[model samples]
Target chain A: MGAWRHFPIFMITVPLLGAVLLPFLGYVREKWVPYASLLPLGTSALLGVLLIGRIPSGGYLSYHMGGWEPPFGIEIRLDYVGLFLMLVVCGITTLALVYSRRYIEKEVSGGRRTAYYVLYLLMSGAMLGFVATGDIFNLFVFMEILALSSYALVAITGNRNAVRAAFKYILMGAPSSIMVLLAIGFLYSVTGTLNMVDLAGRIAESGFTEVLIVSYILLVVGFGVKAALFPLHMWLPDAHSIAPSPISALLSGLLVEVCAFALVRITLSVFTMRASDLVMGTADAVGVAAAAAVLYGGIMAILQKDLKMMIAYSTVSHIGYIFLGLTAFTAEGLTGAMYHMLDHGLAKACLFLCAGNFIYLKGYRRIEDLKGAWGQMPWTCFAFALASLSVIGIPPTAGFISKWYLILGNVEGGKWLYAAVLLAGSILAAVYCLRVIYYMFFQAGKEGAWEEYWHDAPPAMLLPVWVLSLATLFFGVFSFLIIPSLLKAAAYLL
Target chain B: MKKVAALLFISALAVLLLYVVASMPPMGDPDNPTATHVIPRYLERAEEETHTVNVVTGVILNYRGYDTMGEVTVIFCALAAVLAVLGRERRGVIHGFVDRSEVPASVIVKTMVRFMVPFIILFSVYTILHGETSPGGGFQGGAVIGGSMIIFTTIFGLYESSRRIPLKVRAPLEGAAVMGFFLVGSLGLVGGGNFLTYAWPRVAQGLHPSLVVWLTVLVEVGIGLGGAMVLTSILFAMIREEEEIAPAS
Candidate 1:
């Protein structure tokens, strides 16, 4: 019981220490690299669950770095929102690490495998810190760690397109980082303290409305690009689709979502004042653009040639849903967004892992090539079908529960048009998500190539896929357990 | 039309940025929140609390050392990024990005570099050791050391550089920065203090001042070495490819 006291720092540091150890360990034994990478994330995930269990009823866990008070020292606070984000980060990353074992052998060159795992561990560790930290500048540092690792991971395949995509990522990503830095600068100037709770108390008192509003816009735009919100989403599909699949899973499933979580954290906690109508309009504008992204993503997803690319586009749509709920400014919307972050993370990660299996088993990249894929790899296709239903928000999966809350949230906020967009968007999701499921099970075109590779993915890869895919179903029926907690956390956002 | 749209957007952004700038508190104002609220505590008690002559170092290495730990990880990540993309350097290979001109540096140029390398290294060590008491710290010293590596490579070729700083030597040190944090922070934990706590009350009933000094020294050395190695490797990886890439045809 007392062990949970230092769990927050341990959760972040363990994986970082693993990343530091991986290269040297690679020299000792090549096979040890995969399991070595898994251990830290596995431990981080365990720590995360235990830490969440220890959360005092309605109270948060705070660790002040250097034993300094909140105003002076760096603090790591795991409130309900951060606890939820931490669970998603640690849990999904552990699964991704499990899947990366066999999949990375072919996708990454042998020499770079250690480097790839190192970046993956660093990215996950930074995300754990990013969510759990209570300080703003510390958040920026974690952002860079995560972002730099993501850029490296994207280009890890070392092909021309992968490198090009990663460059585009850095181009957009790096400038956005500077924008984030400027925003942090603006914030530090306005309020001397870098701590989030301290800033929340000081912001309203400072009353420098215009400067605060500008900084808020800067943070939003900066994180908006990272989250891949529309008009800012050009870098996502290529980067997500080109990387090896587990990396794709981590990028689509968690990285963009964490950026959005950072945005939500700053919005709800740091800047609670009604600085201006401009602020409201800005939120509304983000919501509107998210609506556009939903539709844009859905329509484009239907037309994609590549399987993972389609899932990447679907991620854009799901991101739209989260931001839609987020900007609606209703407790229902916020809860829905938080829930969607989990459900979407699980579903999308499952979808990509299944896609990776297809590529692993049959070298299936395009939708057309997946025709009769079920004949060869029944389990992956089955997992795909189950998760895609969630993506379409069917009645019995966790995605439906979150999507329902999203719709309910919009309606509660009187944002009827966005609510309708939510409905239409899912219908579009049905078309795109089901199209692949339909191809694998129904279509039998060009039978020889599809049937040539006639074995399912090995269980190492298949089990994680099934676990994620099934959780969507299990959570869908049982979401009531966590929904109240999510709603409570959302209410505290004010 | 695309260019026009981009220009228009950039202009709008500039205007917005200007508006924010116009609203900011005037720079160096005595009553600015940064001066009145943020600086005084750090400037006033930092030397006594962290025991470093340079207040900035005391603040960076002791109070907010976690951020610097993250920064070193970022540096390490950048190196990983380059290695992952271009691949690591092997002893006997050359890359297209490497200078391929047959003519080597003149004897005097090589001699001068060979002579200056020692001085450069000595100065860097001096900078790193005296970092807590002065303006230069791990990053500055590390940059100088890294510059020496690049210069040595530029004149003496990649092979000589590799021989001097072999993969075995460099591989382990690349993560020294993060490892340094883990070790130092755990020292705090050993005393029942929080992570990254260099010096705190009642830890070990009375933690020694020298222990805190040792923590900063190790962290500074770790960062200095980690940064220098990452930069050196990234440069080497650029010029040297593991499997010769067919010499770019």
Candidate 2:
């Protein structure tokens, strides 16, 4: 029962243990394995709810593995920030898995279904671990865990393009990993200790200077690739387009959020505000790069043709919003960025899932082909409309609140140009989102001028999509539950 | 041939020149005084607290378990990539070139290979398990397991080996293994410890800290297994030209 007391950890564990057990279980009936795999996650999600309620605000919680102390034994650390992130990731993961049951049964072959579940569970655990881990080196380990699982999950379709995209993702991903590893090596060479709290203390003791500046750059670039910050986001669209829908939801929704969370964690925790001021003379370079990402991602997304691919490109744009808020270096900016992280996650996951639903129901990929989809799958399209509105920063949607903070942050910083760019990016987002919406409702299907491509999705699919869609509005309306938590998380970081 | 040789020669020369340039550290080192930092001091102090022969492992598994989790995800991403790409093919009955010869495994070789599997797995487990107090880690263990799988594929036909453990099973196993590693790492979180910072006495009480360390190692073993299976399955599907592609349709 004490073991169950650590259910937060078990939520991550049951699925992980189940992963190892799954291969051996294959010797039994094949059909039962994916279902068996779902049990751990279902259990993990239930545990996650309990864990979230248990975690207190602004307080640190530590769980010893085998009872080891800091700088000696292994530890699992949780804060309100960590717990909240874990809840979002685990909760979405549960729904994604539920949706995957019917989706995979229809789309993937019987033999490969087990592998899909394995990769999916691995990804879920890795994302949770990424959020929960306290140590620097442990963060790197989780990064790889999530990276490899994501790679496999993306390639699961086994299309030639999936293979090619995975290969390219690796080509880009490997260097990023090596870069981060080298940065860690440099950090070790300088600081020695890899513990974040200890490292923070040591850094404070000495003082921030130039060499630390280089380390900051290295770490930013390293995490930047994962965070999809502008130039570094070249691999994102292709990778996202090629992966399966649930995998895409995991990737666009929860996985990248963890990476962004790492960036936020490192910037605020490792450097603290004082060190950040001293180290880079200001994180101005990061700020500038983030601004570029906003403009670049928005502009590039406007140019895409494929529906999923457009959403993928749009992710590049939205990530810019995350980074832009982060770089504001103000508490409001940071809080807004973190809040946007959750908001974008819900909105994007729904959008991608809806896109996948459209593709599956109708053999179409182009933005133009979505014409008349509203009449065919009204519920799905309505969900899409809500998610799209949320993403576009429409009033009464979650995205608007986050963007409002961002624009206000820019204005407060007296960087009116950045504010202008933010507004423009929002407009661009609306443009692309409306492109699909317009075609879906107004344009006729290929059957003829009057013909409509209308077919509602299975209840399983609609349920997850609508749930996320509604949450987008719910969070927008009652931003209070999360806004304070985001503020606390920001204070912890900033 | 001249172009190739010249390109190789130039590349080697460039590598040598870069090494020369890098050996100087940075020009502003004296003004910067990089080494006289406090984090370095803690690292210096780490040797006492960790009591591990290898400081690198001590920092990795114990000090920065969080980052190590991210690093493990990188490998997980690779394995997932392979699974996503290769696992979707339709398996069909043979209709093309077939291996007519029954190339049975020799008893001695089979015995040796069989003996080798447990030890390889054991050593990989040892590496990850002892990482807090030793040199190897999750990546190292995963590589070792992957190495063992290569042996399995070489001796057994890809078909038989893959059939024994299909991608469906392999994917879930991979997922669970990674999830398990994360879960173990997160144990400190639930136990009221920081993400990977366990207070040795309270969490373990009378138990040796090594017990907790060993659990982390065990988690790595699972990662190693999944990592190995995913990698081997991918390589097998890519390289193995069976008589017929499995027909999913």
Note the DockQ of each predicted structure: 0.75, 0.25
Listed per candidate, the RMSD to the true structure in angstroms reads 2.3, 6.2
Best by the DockQ measure? 1
Candidate 2 segments whose C-alpha is farther than 4 A from its true place: A1-5, A25-27, A273-282, A448-454, B1-83, B88-97, B100-249
Q: Which stretches of candidate 1 lie over 4 Å from their true place?
A: A274-278, A452-454, B91-103, B200-207, B241-249
Q: For model 1, what is the error of residue B201's alpha carbon versus the real structure, in angstroms, after optimal superposition? A: 3.4
For candidate 1, the clash count comes to: 0
Predicted candidate 2 versus true structure: per-residue lDDT over B29-58, tens digit per residue: 633324454335436866554445566765
Per-chain TM-score, chain A, candidate 1: 0.98
lDDT of 1 by residue, A352-467 (tens): 99989988876878998888887888888899999998999998899999999999999999999999999999999999988888888898858377665558888999999999
Q: Model 2 over residues A7-37: C-alpha lDDT tens digits?
A: 6657665665565566445545667876787
- Give Cα distance to truth, residue A71, candidate 2, Å: 2.6
Give the alpha carbon lDDT tens digit for every residue of B36-96 in model 1. Answer: 8767989999887887889988888888989988988889888888878887754344333
Native-to-model Cα distance after best TM-score fit, residue B7 in candidate 2, in Å: 13
Docking quality category of candidate 1 according to DockQ thresholds: medium
